[model samples]
Target chain A: MELHDKIRILADAAKYDVSCSSSGSNRENKNGGIGNASFYGICHSWSDDGRCISLLKILFTNVCIYDCSYCVNRCSNDIERALFTPDELADLTINFYRRNYIEGLFLSSAVYKSPDYTMELLIRTVKKLREDYNFNGYIHLKAIPGADINLIRLAGLYADRMSVNIELPSEKSLKLLAPQKTKESIIKPMSFIHSKLLEKSESKKLMRHTDKFVPAGQTTQLIIGATPESDRTILKLSENLYKYYDLKRVYYSAYIPVFNGNNLLGVSSPPLLREHRLYQADWLLRYYNFKADELLTEEELNFDVLLDPKINWAMKNLNLFPVEVNTADYNMLLRVPGIGLRTAKRIVKARKAANLNYDSLKKLGVVLKRAKYFITCNGKYYGGCEIETNKIKNKLLPKSNVLEGQLSIFDSIYKTESNLPILV
Target chain B: MVNYIFDGTFDGLMTVIYVSYYNRQIPNDILSENSYQKNFLGDDIYISTDINKSDKVQNAITTKISKEALKNIYYVYLSELESSYMLIYKYVRLGFKIGRKINYFLQNDIVNDVIKLSQRINHEAYKMIELIRFKEIKKGLFYAKIHPDYNVLPLIVPHFAERFQDQYFVIHDVKRNLSAVYDKKSWIITDIPPEITLITKEEEDFENLWKIYYKSISIEERKNLRLQRQHMPKKYWDMLTEKQ
Candidate 1:
């Protein structure tokens, strides 16, 4: 295939990986680098999926040797095959960067004849971008499982971040849906990168002076609703990964059934709402300082469809309500229903100025519709007279019909935020 | 009545506001950049460019409104809205009467109008962090020239400083002949030299990668330029890396 043709195929193949953050790296341009990466910042664009296109995510090649039943670019699937030489991909990356089209490259690939060859192409493309093209911008490369350990390590040096898709939650699901892949092949490289990050972290002064390994760290995606694992199981796996692997992100992709596997659990799309709820829960885990047990039990396959993860937690723990925002510790403030990180920080800042009043609390953009049930204003309860959990559920239900009527067949979808109804 | 005219800067606005607050009978009109002779058929007029007097006026208003409040009024003036020039005068006058409770003006429509203009400038400044992709030029100087919808040159420095810590760079807002320069240690608001031409950007190494990434990530099945244009209008494209 021509270079452009290869770019087309590989890029389309790699679109399914959605980890796009390029912030929190201290990489800089030097004698011959083409771009630099920054901390606390990342460039973003919108995909057709409305997903933020922060990185120029693509693949080095889409021609695979292994047949993963869930993937569209699997070897068994009859699709156009292509591959790009490292130099060609590098040149394209530089061109795009110059035009301000993207922050950096997100290079991934199918097996492409062999696992080692695919890893080599991915590594070479990043090296050409770093050494030959002098590009210093962010580059996120996918570590191909079953590739040589040395190759994965080299790839890490050239890329700012890396990800290996866990794809499914359990070994049984993997065996049933993708017989060619194994649990060890995926986890082994991830464990290696995690330890390497730790080693680099230990020699922090030297790594600080020199360019570090994957300053944006690593991420991985899990396909939701593809296996029978409950939300509890998924959250437990995520908790372990965070505790052990120190993964930067764990993306949940809803299964969109383009093809059927004999062992696939669902035929229709995994509820996108379920995916959204998972993100909310993930946010609670990462930012709101909540545990998986606080939000869900082993029996529940999903969170309450009507409420957000934080609000649901607040509903479950009504005893924690009417907590004084003025005296609440940072973690407790973080758990308040209407308060987000920004609001929490703002409260901390505003409280130092003077004792915040109920009026002032509302002015800080606190969503009283839900927060009233969780907080007291000037030591006075405003959640409601009874404040029953079931009553609060009906009262606290946000206006869901926001974009539902807004997305009529003839209406413009982009003009609205959502297609669901808000039943307050 | 004497005119307290000063150079076109925040100091100049401050001087005028300070002088106007001390008295209520001074009828004045402003002439800036281009002055044309009009038929002064029925009215008597006084022309003044007393920069020192303007400075005196600014000092007094700073005392009356507090330095922070006065500084905010000056930022509103920089927004360059025609009403902004008058709004600053009225709000400052109101501030002098209201004392330290000048924040009440934030609710008044006239004050809110100027706030909107200031918000536009601030928004442009924020977008600069996201949209202003830099290209390294000769001598390790990183530069990016932007043509933004609002004059946001003054507000982008702090964000870039926190983000790109060790780098030295210049963000030029071509529309207003203004730029922000950060030299690793500190940032300064300055202007581009008149002798130098604005550098024309070409398809550099990173641009190729970015364009390919853009084309590759855009699924042909779900290409929606209308939605894209709605979120990011074409006018904002010149400064945008991908659109450019």
Candidate 2:
């Protein structure tokens, strides 16, 4: 088959992975090397679904042995199959990088023939790209489950990032969907990469120049809505993975049903809004110093689709609101729904010079429409209405999902003369 | 109210700040020489581009504030906003008064405005570095065109130069009629005359392949054109290979 045909089939097979971020490590071009990695990864293009495309994400082959129900390339599924030789893959990556088509390569594959064989082909392809081609660009390689530990470690040295996807969140789902694969087969490689990364960092302190092992660190993806796992369960697992493994990121790929025949899958895919809410809650867990238990409960299986997780949390904890912004600590300021990390830092710095009023807070990039109810400036409450839950909810909810131009209760009462664009 | 007119250059902007501080009066407005507004009421001063005076002001910023702040001020000048000159003038005056402590005053409108302008410029430059698509026009020569919201051609070339060190490429900012030409050894920014067309036979083939791959990778079940446009705005649509 032609190379273009292979790219279409292989790229189509690989699109479901959805972990195309090429960031978190900085590698300069060597004297003879052709490319480098920036700390802030660049999005080369946006795919139609709005996800950033940072790498040439493709699978080595779409042919598979295991019959995972959620997978597009399962053995039972009939899809066009193609494979790229190590040389063709390496050359395609270099050619694309030269034309500035991608930051690097995201190489994944189904278990073609066997796990070990598929992993061997992947290793050969990446090793050729790095050593033979003198390619110094970012390479995110997948660690095939049940592959040799030595092979995983060796691939880590050449790749900038590595991931062993826990495709299903729980062991029960792994058993139900993919009987051939066990949870241990997936997690063993993850622990191996985690230990190797730890060793590399420790050795770097002692020795001036130690070989880099997955310099951008590791990440994994979990398929949401495929199985009947609650949001609380998913987030709890993610928090543990972050705390224990020191993983860089845990991506949540919303399940898109490919095979219609299976009774095990849903008739229609889950709402994208659910996926978006999970991302917001995940951000709070990662950056805003919120714990999993704080944000979730057994009664509330999932986040409210209408309200964001931060606002939901704030509304639940109203006593925390009406906190004086002039005297609030950085943590307290961060908890306000509208103040981001940048705005909180700005408020901290600006408040030292002058006591910030509502106008000053807006100038500092705070979303005053949401923040005014929660905060007080200089012992004065600018929020007109008494603190009430349903009233605040009515004020914050979009007039309709179609258009976000809903006038809040405050907007109806007072209108500003200046027509400066609101950042929010 | 005093009005200061300056050449559209960073050095000229710095010279205006130096002259304003030396004269000991806050100008009501600073206008670029190219601006259309003619005001007969205020005293209008045409400030010549003085390198020595500009250098003195630049040095004071480095000593009083920081090198990073000076670099940001330069980026703000690249914004080409009409009010940027006066805003920057007011900002530097405050910087000199507060010395190094001026960095902490985020509440001040002048300080915050300068920071916001630089952020806007930097964001556009970063987006251009990602969205730029180079087509192979000759054996070893590649070319791409863009129309970024900010004048970010000066900022993007260094990144592309370092990334594609052994090749020659030209990145044209079509809106500004400016192009950064990069040879294997070095790069130089130059003006491109009208009626220049850059195309190649093989370029179409590559573009078709890229568009195919772009389409194939997107999940049909999760198509969100609005979200796509939010990240890759409509203004940059024409220059993109896939979009074209």
Candidate 3:
């Protein structure tokens, strides 16, 4: 097949794996290297779906041996299959980087022939890019499940980041949809990468400036709404992954329906809002020191689509609010509905110099509309009239369809002072 | 009311600040040369670009306040806002009076304005870094043209230089008629002709692939053009290969 045809087929197949970030790694270009990774990722363009096109996210091939029901390129699907030669893929990446079309390559593949075979092809392409082409850019290689540990280790040295998709939330869901992929196959690589990363850090302590091993760390993706997994279950699983595997990110891809009548997966497509709320809750967990149980419970299986996860938590725990803005510590300030990581830090720094008022807080980047109800300035409350939960909820929730304006799907990127979203 | 005129350069603005500080007089307005308007009743003072005076003022700011404060001042100056000259003058005056603690006085209109102006400039520079797409022209030279709201050429050049160390590239600020050229080893800022066209025969194939990838990646069920425009604004569509 022609190169353009191959790119279209492979890239289209890989688009479902929505991990389009090229950040969090600080890989500099060597003397004769062609590119470098930006600590804060750069967005080359926005897709029509309003998603960032950061890395040149494409699969090495779309031919699969495993028949995962939720996937587009499953074995049963009679889709056109195409693969890129190692040299061809490397040359394309260099040309694309030279034209400033992408940050780097995000190469994944279906289980074509076998897991080890697919992984070997991926390792060959990346090695060619890194060693032969002298490309020092950010590469996020998806580690093939059930692939050899040695193969993964060698691939990790060249790639900045690696991921293994925990496609479904639960073991039951995995068995029901993807029989070929066991929970063990997915978790084993994650555990191995975690240990290797720990070993790398320990060696670095012994000898300063040690060798690299997945310097950006490992990330995983869970297909939300494909199975009957609650938000609580997903968050709990994600928390454990963060604690145990030291994963950089747990990407939640809103399950988009490829096959209309697939009885295995009931839902046509997961509401993008649900995926968005999970991302918000994910951010709160990572940055705001919030636990998964605090965000949701088995009773409250899903997040409120109308309100953000943080604001919902704030509404439930109103007693914590009316915290003194001037006296509140950084963590407490962060709990406020509108106060993000950057704004909270700014308030802390700005308050050291002078006593802060509502206006000063606004100047420091706090969203007064939401924060005012939760905070007090100099023993004065600007939140106004009878601090009732219903009133506050009404104020916080939009009077009209708030999602129309607010539901940008990628609001986490634009709204949070942090440029890179939680997915990165 | 007295109006002070400057040469529209950062050094000239600093010289104006120096003159105002030494003379102990607050001008009603400080205007860049192109922005200065003659008024029959108001007194006018045209400050020349004195490098020594500007250097002294720069040193004073660096020594007394902080390097961060100086950076903020420079960012605010690059904004070229309608009231930037006077606003920066007031901010500098306040800084000199309060020493290093002027940033804490967010209640002061001048201090708040300066901070906000610098934030705006920084936001623009960040956008420029993300949205500036280089097109490969003839002889493997990558050329990117940007018309940023703020003068962010100096701010974004360092990022490109470090990233594209092995490749020849030019990031041209078309609105300002200035170009930053990087030739693998080093880079220099120089003036360029307004209508320079450089395109390779094979560039179209790469652009087509990018556009194809962009279109294929978007999930049609969740199409939101409004949100896309918020980050990758419509003003930058012409320069983007995928958009083309």
Pick the DockQ winner: 3
Q: Give iRMSD, candidate 1.
A: 6.5
- CA lDDT for candidate 2: 0.81
**For model 2, how does the per-residue alpha-carbon lDDT over A1-424 read when each residue is reduced to its tens digit?**
9988998999999988868878877777876468888876767887776666789999999889888888888888877889899998998888788888899999999998888899999999999988887788899999988888988988998899999999888999999988888999999999999998888889988999988889999999988888889889999999999998988878887777666558565537544556666766777787789988888888888887677788888888998788898999999888888787778888899888887877778888787787888888888887778888988888778533312211121111111101111122
Indicate the docking level reached by candidate 3: medium
Query: What's the ranking of the predictions by DockQ, best on top?
Result: 3, 2, 1
In model 3, which regions exceed 4 Å deviation? A398-424, B37-40, B194-198
Give the CAPRI rating of model 2: medium
Could you tell me every candidate's TM-score relative to the true structure?
A: 0.76, 0.92, 0.94
Q: Pick the TM-score winner.
A: 3
Q: For candidate 3, lDDT tens digit of each residue in A1-424?
A: 8988998898888888878778788899887678898877777777777777778899999988888888888878887899889888888888888877788999999888888999999999999988888889989999999999999999999999999999999999999999989999999998999999999988988997877888888899988877888899999999999988888888888777766447554675445777777887888888889999999987887887777788788888988878998899999988887788877877887787788877778778777787788888998999885577899887766643333322242342432211222221
Ranking by lDDT: 3, 2, 1
Poorest lDDT segment (10 consecutive residues) of candidate 1 chain A: A410-419
Q: Residue B187 error for model 3, in Å? A: 2.0
Q: Write the per-residue lDDT of candidate 1 for residues B1-244, one digit (tens) a residue.
A: 3333334566555555545555554434432322324434533332344577767766766786677666667667667654555577777667677766565344355545555566566655645666677766634456777887655676666656654555667777788787788777688877754233344354254455455656676644334455555445567677655566
RMSD to true structure for each model, in Å: 7.1, 5.4, 3.1
State the weakest 10-residue window (summed lDDT) of model 2 chain B.
B192-201
Model 1 regions lying over 4 Å from their true place: A205-211, A260-263, A299-301, A401-424, B1-7, B10-78, B81-122, B132-147, B154-244
